[model samples]
Target chain A: MMVSQRPSEVSTSAHERVYRTLRSRIMYGEIAPGQALTLRGIGREFEVSMTPARESVRRLVAEGALFLSSSGRVSTPELSNERIEELAALRALIEVELASRALPRAHMALIDRLQGINMTVAEMISKRDAVGYIRANLEFHRALYLRAQAPAMLAMAETVWLQMGPTMRALYGRLRRTEPPRNHKLIIAALKAGDEPGLRLAVRSDVTQGLRMLAG
Target chain B: MMVSQRPSEVSTSAHERVYRTLRSRIMYGEIAPGQALTLRGIGREFEVSMTPARESVRRLVAEGALFLSSSGRVSTPELSNERIEELAALRALIEVELASRALPRAHMALIDRLQGINMTVAEMISKRDAVGYIRANLEFHRALYLRAQAPAMLAMAETVWLQMGPTMRALYGRLRRTEPPRNHKLIIAALKAGDEPGLRLAVRSDVTQGLRMLAG
Candidate 1:
C-alpha cells in the first residue's frame, strides 16, 4: 500500500487502469480463490479514489470474473467440485465450436505457431511456473479462437478462464506431475484431420482432463 | 433540466439511478444502436452530477451492453450482419450445450413451467408487446439454462442477449407475427423425450429462427 501511493500513479483514468490491472492479476492467477479485496485496498494499491475502484469491482463481479459476497466482500470464486465440472463443461461447449471454426481459417502456419507456443508451455510446466503455463496455454487457444473471428464467443471463453484462474492455479500446483500432457499433439492431429467431431472430442478431453484428474 | 433542480425528488443513489435509467432506455430500444449518448445529457436527465453519470456509462460500456466511441461518447452497439450471425452462432454453441445438460434435469414440472410461460409469450405476441415477448422468451430460455447449472455459460449467453436487445426490438416490431413457430413445440417434445441430438436440433432451430427472421 505504501509503495502504491506515489503521485505519478494517479494520472490515467482510474477505472480502465483498475480494470486492466486487476483483470491481468486475476487472469495470471496472482489472486487466490476466496481471497478478499476491498474497494479501499484496491484504491490504495492503484492510487485511485474509492469510487472508481468500486465501479471496476462491480463490473468484474457482473462478468463473474470476481465474486461478491452477500456482505459485499469481493474475491476470486471458490469452486465446488461440481461447479468446476460445469465450467469445464462450458469450456468444452464454447471452445470446440471455436476450434472447428478456427480450423478452416488455420493453415499450416497457424499450426506451426501453436506448436511453437506449446514448447514454451512445456517449458513452463517443467519449470513449475503455473502463471507461465496458464498464460502460454491460453495463448495457444486464443490464437485458435482468433481465427474463429467470433469476438463475443471468444470473450465469453476468456471470462470462463478468468473465473477459473485461481482454482486452476491451486489445481495445477497440486497435480504438478512436472509436465503438461501430450494432448496438444492430439489436438493438432484432430485439427489436421479437419475432423470436427474429433476436434470437439479433443478439446473436451483437454478441458475436462485436469478436473477429472484432481477429483480422481 | 429544471426537474433535476427540484430538490424534492426522492433521493436515490445517483450512480445506480443513472445506470438503471440509461440501461432501461437502451434495452427498451428507446435509444437506437450507434446513437451517441453524452455524459452531460445523462447527468442532466437523471438530475445527478457528471461524475456519477460518467461512471454509469463506463460500467455499462464494460458490460458490452454499451459501446464507447473513440471520443468517449457512449452508445448502444451497432452490430453488422456478420456480427449478428456471429452472435447467433454463439447462441448455438452455448445454448445447445446448455440444452443437453439441461435435458436430464428437465422433468415434468420444469416442462409444465415452460409451457405455462409459453402461454404468456403467446399473449405478448397477440398483444404485440415486443418488450414483454422478448423478456418472457429470455425467461423461458434462462429457466432451461438453470437445469444445466452452468453459470458461466449462462452469463455468456446473457451478454449476447444484452448486446442484441435493441436489434431484437427492431426485429420483433417488423415481424409482428404471433407464434414462435412449431419449433418451440418441438423443443418441449425433445425435452420430454430426453433426446440429445433432437434436443440440440430443436435448440438450434429455436436459437436460429430469430436471426433468420432478422436477416430476411
Candidate 2:
C-alpha cells in the first residue's frame, strides 16, 4: 500500500515551510522596513497556496515581525524612534541577562565557535552583505546564549532581534563600517576570562549601541 | 443602499474577537495548564467558522499563550520547573525596569488607582477567586507600567505574565494565600516616596517570590 498523506499534513508542512523562510527573511533584514507584501505575492514566491501564505503572515504579525494594517495590507514595520529606543532597552535587558547566565557554562569550544562566527561577521561586513552580517552576528550571540540552558529567555531575546531586523538593515546602510562591531571582541574577551560583569556590559553594548544611534 | 463588508473584513473581526477573548481567558488563568482545545469546539464556543477559529489558535500559539502539538493538537502549555524559573526571572528583569521608569510619572492619581486595584486583589483572595485575583493583580501592575511610556517593555512584561498565568493559578491553589501580596504594598510605598531602588526591589520581589516558591 502506498503511504497516504493527509491534506492537513500537507498544508501543515507547507505553512511551516513558508513561515520559517519568511521569518528568516524578516529576521535577517532581507526585507526592508515598510516593504509591503501581499498574500498572493507570498504564495507565488513560496509556491504555496494562499491558506499557508496567510497563516505565515498572521504568525509573523503576531510576533511583531510584520505589521498588518486595518485595511488588510501587510508590511514590515517602520518603527518610530521611541519604539526603537524601547526595543533597544529590551534587547539590552534580556541579552545582558542571557550572556550572564551563559558565562558559567561557556566552554572553550563555544567561545571558539563564537569567534569563528565573528570572523564570518567581519567577512560579511567587508563584503558589504547586510543580511549576511546580521545573520552571522546573531549566530555569534545565539552560540553563547545556547549554553545558558534558558530557552525562554533566549527566545525572548530573539523576538527582540526579529523586531529590529528591518530597522537594523536600514542602520547598516547608514553606518558603512569597515570592521565588525568592536563589542564583539569585548564579548569574546569577557567570555574567555569568564567575567560575568564584563560579559553583561559587552552584550548590552553590542545589542544596543548601534540601535541607539539609529534611534537618535 | 446596503453596506457590503468584504469577506476579509468579516473574517478579520471574527478572528480578532475570538483571539482576544481566548487570550484573556488564558492570561487570567481561567484555563488551566495542559488544557486541550479543539478548533471545532472553539468555533462552536465563539459561534464563528473554522477559519476564524484556526486563525485565532494560530495567533495565540505564536504569542506563547497556547501550545500546538506536532500532530496538530492545541493546548495551554505545561511549563517545566526550569521554564517557570526562567520566565520568572524575565518578569523580574522587565517589570522592575518598567516600575522604575514609571516612578517619576507615578503621580498621586496613579498611586490612588493602584491602591484601589490592590483592594480588589485582596477581595479576590478572600473570595478565593483565582482568575479574578490574577486579573486584578495584573491590573495593578499594568496600571503602573502604562505610565512608563515604554510599550515594548510593557508588552514584553505582559508576555511573561501571560506565560505564567496558568502556573499562577496552580500556585494560587497551592498557596491558599488569604491576603494580597505583601510586596505590592512595598511597591506602592516606593512609588509614593519616589524611591527608584525601592521600587525596583519591590517589583522584583513581587514578580519572582511566589514563582520561585512554586519552582522550588
Candidate 3:
C-alpha cells in the first residue's frame, strides 16, 4: 500500500512473488491489455531476476491470461466477442453450480458479510475507486462461492474473472458508477429462502447479466 | 513424429520446443505422476540449457500439468479424490457442451471417422497396447470435439486430460483391458440418430461412468 521504491515482498518465493505481483497488476487492470511486457522490463520493475520474470510470464501464458506470439513477445490476452461468449458460458455453468451448492450453506451471517462488502463496493464505485470496487465486488462473489467447497470449480471461475480484468476496467470506466445491482439483494433473499431455482437464476444473472448489459 | 537427438531444439525456440516435448510426453503418460523432475535433469535429458527447461516447466506449472513445491521443486501433481471429482465435474460440464454443440454440425464423415477410431481403440485394448489405445482414444475424442469448433474450450479440456495423464496411465494399467464400453457404441448411435439427449447421456456416461467404475 505504500509508495516505495521496493515492491512488497509478500509471503512467497521470488518467482512466485513476481508472478503474483504481475498477475495482480494485470488482473486489477493496472496494466492495459495488448501492452507488450518484456521479461527484462518485468524483471526490472519487480526487482527480480530474468528467470523469475520469464517463469511468471510463462505461467500466465499457459493459463491464457497472457499471450505469447510465435516470436515469443508477451502481452495480456485480448479476447474476441466469440471467445468472451464462450468464457461467459463457462462462468455460467461453473458459477451457477457453485451458487447452487453454496445456497444451502449460506447463512444469515454470510449474507450480512456479502451485504457489507457490496456496500463497500458501492461506495468505491461512487468514489470512482476502480481497483477498490473490483476487489470488493469480487470478494462478495468469492465469499458466496466459498460455500460450495469446490476448490477446482472456484479456481476455474476465478480464471475467467482474471481474464476479464482489463475489459472490466474499460467497462466500468464507461459507466457513471451505477448502483450495485438490485439483483445481488435478490440473490441474498433467494439464498435465505432456500429457493434453489431462484438462487440459481439470481446467481446466473449476477454472473452473466451484467455482461449482456455491457455487450448491449 | 520423429524423435530428436536434440529433443528441445527442433527449429522452434528452445524453450517452446522443450515445452511441447515435455507436455506431449506428460500427456501421453510417459511420465509417472508424483515423479520429481529437476530443471537440471530435464535440461540434460532434452540437451538444452537450463533456461529453456525452466521456461517449459513454468508453462506446465501454468497449465496445472505440473506442480511446483514451496521449495521451488517441480513434480507431477498428486491429486486427491476430491480433486479428481472436481475435475470430473469440470469435464462433464465442458464435454457435454462440446458434444451438444457438435451434434447438429457433426458430419457423416466425422461420425464415421470417430467410429473407425473407436474400433482401433478396441483393437489396441484387446492387444493390451496401452500406448496405442491411449493414442486412439484421444484421437476419437479430439475428432468429436473438433466438430464443436471451440478450440479454446477444447484446449482447456485437453489441458485437463494432460494433467490426468500419468494418473490415467496408472489407472488403465492396473485394470485389465476390456471391450470398449457399450456407451461408446451408444454415443456413435446417438450421433447418427441425431438424438440430442441420447448424445448428451452417452457422452456423460462415457465420461463419468468410467470414473465411477474406477471409484467403486
* TM, every model: 0.87, 0.94, 0.92
Residue B8 lDDT in model 2?
58
**RMSDs, each prediction?**
4.1, 3.3, 4.2
A78: Cα error in model 1, Å: 1.6
- Return the interface RMSD of the candidates, in order shown, one decimal each: 2.2, 0.6, 1.0
- Tell me how many clashing residue pairs each candidate has: 0, 0, 0
Residue pairs with backbone overlap in model 1: none
RMSD of 2: 3.3
Candidate 3 reaches a DockQ of 0.75
In candidate 1 chain A, where is summed lDDT lowest over 10 consecutive residues?
A1-10
lDDT per residue for candidate 3 within A1-216, as digits (tens), equals 433334555556677888888777777767666778999998888776687788888888877778889788998877777777777777788888889889888889999998888798778878887777777878888999999999888888887788877766666677774676667888888988999999888878877765775777
Measured by TM-score, how close is model 2 to the native structure?
Answer: 0.94
Model 3 iRMS (Å) reads: 1.0
Model 3 sits at a Cα RMSD from the real structure of 4.2
Local accuracy of candidate 2 as per-residue lDDT tens digits, B1-216: 433445655654888999989989999998999999999999899777788899999998988999999899999999998899999999999999898889898899999999999999999999998889999999999999999999989888888888888888888877655866799999999998888999999899988887767855
lDDT of each residue in B33-101, candidate 1, tens digit only: 687788899888876778778778876876788987766677889888887888898888888888888
| CA-based DockQ, model 1 | 0.53
